[model samples]
Target: MTNSKNTGLVPPSAFALGGDLNVTRIGYGAMRLADGPERPADPAAAAIWRPPADRAAALDVLRAAVEAGVNLIDTADAYALGANEELVAEALHPYAEGVAVATKIGVLRPAPDEWVPLGHPAYLRQQAELALRRLKVDRLDLLYLHRLDPAYPIAEQVGTLRRLQEEGKVRHIGLSEVTVDQVREARETAPIAAVQNLYNLATRGHEAVVDYAAEHGIAFVPFFPIAMGAHAGPDGPVAEVARQIGATPAQTALAWLLRRSDTIVPIPGTSSAAHLKENLAALELALSDEQFAALSALGQDEAADGVAA
Candidate 1:
């Protein structure tokens, strides 16, 4: 279960987020780049969710992430209600070749603090266009429908995305927070490159979809990769394994995810250069089978809590 091959260097793996694109196993998430009420005005306060050390430092962190070989940058239209995308474009525009910026539509943030689903065909089309304009790209590398709208048929939503693809506005289609059956339904309309769902060591409600994506060559990008907090507390399995390997629990969680599936890409977000560097270093931590099993079991227990709820 141990990896003697570890020269204490991060393992290099490439994941195609859909299309001809390939990027390193660790990706960056820009959800914390916004200057708004949802995020902290001061970067140092934990109560202020998703705060950066400072504006200049936030930009530096992003630049450092890409310089460190993070090629996939995940953001959403609703994140900071479009501010995240703007920051990403500002930070990485004149973007390097092979760098992919994956943005999502379908979720609306009427206020900076509220999220509402607005996946009507017209809304979807409009948001995609807006994202294209904001990112200042002719074609979005990967465009995801942020969530499925129960008010409308899934086909209608997927059909709209397909039309965008046909028009050459979007290079690849993606889905977020979807079930396995929804993925099948979406693929019938257009090729799907990836799925972004809330997944981490403490949350695995979409393991079926993650497994299916791995089996079928679709990328599975996990958001909130380091949100386990107290669940991975001292003396916990994640902590125990982390201690044995000389890695932080957050890094251990990310390493376990990388070892879980080749298609799995963890986009851990941060607005600090130090934390961003630490998160990306997870690529270097090669987890053992024992560690993976223990973390997997912890996720299962957390899933049971959700089901019991």
Candidate 2:
């Protein structure tokens, strides 16, 4: 928690995802381990010819994360057309107790760079089955509908996950990239346990969503959670603060998010084991009230000057 390096670190405190799945507040995102684009310009070709990520390396990262006390690992089927999930299985099929693996469905890759929503009850059910097989699990620790299907009713989409929970395929259901209203609506249809959204120091438009998740005891997971813009400048507040505390700007950003709300779980992803350790070490960087407030107020000056936040 200081400028001096500390070895054999203990990870950040744990959070109860869905009020039951105990996981470290600082978790790892599996997307980077996939070694492929989120949406390929040629998904069909990539699927047919794409090579797997370094198997030994990916396994090392997974084992390292677990050893670091990262109990929660986030991923989706759309990532690498299922290779990521398979790799997770290959790396940690006989998952240790207390390790929670979360995955998503409802988005499909149909053509080159094309994403299709398949929220039909049958499609959702089938994907759950397939994901279970890929992750090599009897039941999923957590399942998220990657995104809302514009063509389908939100209730139906959430309701499908409820059915899966009833069938014991998934223990909990969540929504991703949704607004506050959508979270409320989805909750009425089924117990919404978590909300994943794009939130970072550079973007704060989803502030209301974060607040709602906190007030409702729903975990708010921010993907692509990192420092950027003025906050990441070499001479800016973030860098200065990080330097003063002997941490990286990226780690400063993660620490800020940790102080944002107890419900916030920032799953920062990285392909390098070194980077993953660096990101996790941010947990030790506790910010004073002034530091946290400064980060929370980031981009306000730009907005006051008519600059985009």
Candidate 3:
């Protein structure tokens, strides 16, 4: 089986976020903006607690991503406790036209490894103001609730963003790691332009949310969009598909996501410019229905394995 339109390696060049703010389909995730152990023995052991080991190189990566045609840059206040936002501002303070800087609030990082949610209206409002200052922008291009605080009503959290949007502090509101029901609840208080969640070719936990966002015209920004895991090893499913597509396993994963939905704007973060380019190149690798189905089945198998474990 083949898709007549996508059979010839054509990816939608851009997606209109919130009926405006058109950004390239392949965006940059700035989480790796700070210096940290690149590949720790345990992936969870790494942390972004301080400025980049080499601030200049980090800045160069940010600038290079934009220069390479990536328009949406994703960051968070929790990163380096606001230092990451500062880095974004430093690299591109007077943002060029069409460059959208998205920052998330409502998460507290007391310790390097600890992430807690604080959704008090006052705290949320203060963070937004601080983000504007840190990002050196009067109005944030996109502001997301980093995580929902179970202690507070969803309405209260989203309502605060609505108030901020009304005040022109936030041009568009978004949510991270939320359920469809939460999205519905959030819409009652305000419009949600995007939903950022942990989604990829290997992880299907948010499969429903991806569909929901697409049906509602909301952008689904998958954070870890290139995680192919062990299945991407040589002789594994991902590698098999990658060989067939004339690309790397990682590129194959990203291409699968790009072909999965036009509403999806994948933010695959990388500290190296070469790897970033490789990720973006996935846009040109179109998958046929057979290849797409093979990867889809692999994803379901991986997801089921995860659930079993």
Evaluate all candidate structures by whole-model CA lDDT and list the values in order.
0.81, 0.81, 0.88
Ten contiguous residues minimizing lDDT sum, candidate 1: 44-53
Candidate 1: misplaced stretches above 4 Å? 1-12, 38-54, 304-309
Question: Could you estimate the TM-score for every candidate?
Answer: 0.89, 0.89, 0.93
Encode model 1's per-residue lDDT on 1-309: one tens digit a residue: 224643333445777667478888889988767555545444442222333436677678778988888898888887766766877788889899988899999986555445578779999999999999889899998999998999999899999999999999999889999888899988888889999989888787888888899988999998988888666889788888887788888888888888888899989987777888888778778766666677788778766664454
Model 2 scores a TM of 0.89
Q: Quick one: best lDDT, which candidate? A: 3
Q: Residue 59 lDDT in model 3?
A: 93
- In terms of TM-score, the best-performing candidate is 3
Compose the digit string of candidate 2's lDDT tens values, residues 177-285.
Answer: 8988889899988998888888888877678888899899898999989947766999988888787667899998988888788888889887678888998888777
Off by over 4 Å in 2: 3-12, 36-51, 301-309
Give stretches of model 3 more than 4 Å off: 1-9, 36-45, 302-309
lDDT (Cα) of model 1? 0.81
Q: After superposition, how far is residue 37 of candidate 3 from its true place, in Å?
A: 9.3
Better of 1 and 3 by lDDT: 3
Task: Score residue 5 of candidate 2 by CA lDDT.
Answer: 37
Q: How well does candidate 1 match the true structure in TM-score terms?
A: 0.89
